[model samples]
Target: MTQEQVTEFFHQQLGTNACLEAEGYTIDDPPSLDTFIDSYMSGQDIWLAYGSLPVLSQQEWYRIQEVCPQP
Candidate 1:
C-alpha cells in the first residue's frame, strides 16, 4: 500500500489531495501508533519538508502511515 501510495504520490499526481485519494487506513495523528509512524515516515519528506517547523498535510500524513506502518 505504501509503495503504491508513493508511486501515485510521485509519478501519478502532483497535488497533495490527489496523491492521497482512494487509499485506506485512518491516520489522524491521534493514537500513539500514528505518532510513531509519523516520526519514522518523516524521512520521506525530502522535497516538501522544510521550514523551522514543518507542518505536513493530510495526504502526507496518510502517505506516512501507508509507507511506515506501526509494528
Candidate 2:
C-alpha cells in the first residue's frame, strides 16, 4: 500500500484497539509506524489484538470481533 494507505490502515487498527480496550480487554503495545510498515511491506504477519489478548472461546471471539473488527 501507499504511505497514505498504510497510515490509514494504522489508524483503523488503533481505532479497533481503542474499542477493544473500552470493552475491558487487555491490549498489548502497538508497533511503531516504521515497524508496521516494514512488516506490512514484507508480507509478514502483522500483530493483531486477538493474538495479544488471552485465549477466548470461538463464540466470545466472534462477539469481540463484532464489536471491533480487525483493520
Candidate 3:
C-alpha cells in the first residue's frame, strides 16, 4: 500500500485522527511513504497513546465489499 492507502486504511479502521483526539487518544502525523507501507504490511496493531479511554475500543479493516448494495 502507498502512504495514501495506509493513511486511508487507518482512518477507515480508526476514524479520523481528530476523532481519536476527541475520544482522548493522541496520534502522531503519519510517517514517510515507505514506512507507512511497511507498517500496513506488518499486521501489527499500531498503537496510539490513548490513556483513560475504555479498553474495549477496537478497529477492523474497512472493507469495500460491505459497502455497495448487491443486485
- How high is the CA lDDT of each candidate model? 0.38, 0.85, 0.47
What TM-score would every model get versus the actual structure?
0.23, 0.79, 0.34
Of the two candidates 1 and 3, the one with more favorable lDDT, higher being better, is: 3
Put down candidate 2 lDDT per residue, 1-71, tens digits, no spaces: 98789878988888888999998998998899888888888899886655677888999899998988987
How high a TM-score does candidate 1 get? Answer: 0.23
Query: What's the TM for model 2?
Result: 0.79
lDDT of 1 by residue, 1-71 (tens): 47445444333222332323324422222223343345446764323211112456988766655654322
- Look at candidate 3 and give me any clashing residue pairs: none
Candidate 3 lDDT over residue span 26-50, tens digit each: 5666455456557667965553323
List candidate 3 stretches off by more than 4 Å: 1-7, 11-15, 27-33, 47-71
All-Cα superposition RMSD per candidate: 13.6, 1.6, 8.7
